[model samples]
Target: MNEKRMLDDQHFEQMIEEESICTTDNKVYEAPLDALYDTAMHYCPGCGHGVVHRILAEVIEEMGIIKDIIGVAPVGCSVLAYNYLNIDMSEAAHGRASAAATGIKRVLPEKYVFSYQGDGDLAAIGTGETIHTCNRGENILILFINNGIYGMTGGQMAPTTLPGMKSTTSPFGRDVETMGAPLKITDLVAQLPGTAYVTRQSVHKPGNVRKTKKAIQKALEYQKNGDGGTCFVEVVSNCPSNWKMTPVQSNKWMEENMLPFYPLGDLKKPNGKEK
Candidate 1:
């Protein structure tokens, strides 16, 4: 596995070099493959994972820490993240991404570590690991993608699913009376003394995309400084296929519904501020 990883790295690096474009002004622009592999992604049409992956790769490249970063991905839509990200990656059992990331960071204190998880994996089955990891101040970043429903598992309801949100498991829409209100895991963790940064963001708009990237960049920087106990970023995204809406419709629905419940902005900041 190690040998294969090295070979893959070398191959992708070579591809980047070969694809470099030089302008007449003597400036060279390299292809966006420094931290992301060149292969096509497996996410569904209009999925947010592809956009998020690109920004992550850009950040790793900008920070020049491609070799020093490790990512942990658990079961769900992002389970194949290792295949997309060029950096070293580990696959954990469902909802165990935080635990796996904690171990990796502990073993390699010098390296930057993060976990990429979806709503179901992070807010549902993995809730225990996620909360405990944050409370323990694990010194790692947790990238939470909350689409409100299980995108890869037949559109089942998730812990983050909002009231009146329809899913395969909640055909009549989520009922707070019996199903309980949607979990604002980001807000829940922000109150923990162990968490140094907590924010909710999205990528449905160009401006929001920039904010999300900045949030991720800041989270990683906090980890680099080794001051923040835990940095949690929640990206409220859309699930077009599972929601039975066109890519355009999902984004519209998300704006009208998801954004109102899981508002975008920082819930906690390292500078001792909350919004």
Candidate 2:
């Protein structure tokens, strides 16, 4: 009995010493959930949607604009964004996120407004609405997620799909001649006089992810300050399931194929600087 007590005392002392070494100030990272709900995300493994969403929520929280923000998510993989973000999020018809955001922002000019859309919704169906919104120089943020293919609605070829890329509709490959060349919508928008900031980024690498987060933050800040007509941020992401490759393989393929077509960097900036 005495021997057991001595061992227990030694163990207790060791635990106490360890706890003393690990102080609250020593903590490096903690998941941000002030603006996000504590629930499992519906995105596939290695999907960049979750990462973008996290950084967006973090930015909103850090800026102290949770209640002063309104988001529009149209029909796509991100249609259910309201289920995760604990903020005022509204649903829009297919490819009408920008229009809806315009209405909302016009009605409530004091609030921070943004639209979250996917490539299929933005580049194809919502192209007209998107172009007009930017042309009007609406004080809103347009978040475009480009995965090269149509996700959530059968891996079909999207407007942003690269040449020679295979999809459900284009089994042979995306032929630029027959299917029309891949749309450089970001570059196209940058040419418009109303766009204040236009940048293309990716989330497959840690460095790129950090840069994307920073870009998103700058976009919102620009909107708040009325620095430009419109803020457009395109996050070139990967679709592992739709691409029919593992998460690792899809990222590698994106790095090699997608990056070349839709290179990362600022296409336009509010200060007249561009790449």
Candidate 3:
């Protein structure tokens, strides 16, 4: 069984590296390979949460460890991830997903544990837990969805909110003087020795989506191979509904505004993990 699992993982790695999906000449579409149940997502139009979820599910399925995964969700737009992701899931109080995930990992150390969180829940209220968990070198994956504004709480300014960006709470442009600059928490966490990998990415385009998947897949493989540290994947996404722009406009705004501040790239990579 172990040898078969190893072979399966190798097959997946090769398939992922090919960078293209092959199919028949006829265009017969099917639901995503990892859609465990027939349920629709509740995300607003152009929201990146659903795509991120699907990517995680795909990686989990490819790794052949679907049953061995445990997902922790925080109180934000993706609070109901358990519904869409047909896996063992638990919900944490607002900004407490990291804490809950810590306990879950400690108890069920054998399972592939991860926490799905939003910028508001992770960078602001749960800053302490986020720091401590990474500081302690917890062996888990942190999937942080950083969409500058608080999408779940009616477009409030999040800790990651870019300067000159407006939200319900900040009608005028964000005053960096008063609010402080947008927090690059990913960089801050990378400074800690306990963190093994830190990469900021986006799923706004097809090529970016593929890179994001590779980032996640690499992070998971690193974790599985006794890299005793935290793997943080910060996804800089867009909030179209809160921004009051169409999906296309919102994406363009992100490229113009958000990318300038939260540039997408790997901030840190541990020794021997860079490939």
How much does candidate 2 score in TM-score? 0.91
lDDT by residue (113-165, candidate 3, tens digit) is 88999998999999999999999888889999999989988999999988888
Candidate 1: tens digits of C-alpha lDDT, residues 228-268:
78999999999999999999999999999999998889999
Kindly indicate the candidate among 1 and 3 with the higher TM-score.
Answer: 1
Descending-TM-score candidate ranking: 2, 1, 3
Tell me how many clashing residue pairs each candidate has: 0, 0, 0
Alpha-carbon runs more than 4 Å astray in model 2: 1-23
Where does candidate 1 stray beyond 4 Å? 1-31
Candidate 2 per-residue lDDT, tens place, 1-275, comes to 89776787779889879767566788775557788999999999998899999989988998999999999997988889999888999999999999999999999998999999999899999999999999999999999999988989979999999998999999999999899999989999999988999999998998998899899999999999997879999999999999999999999999999998899999999965676
Model 3: lDDT of residue 134 = 91
TM-score of each: 0.89, 0.91, 0.87
Clashes of 1: 0
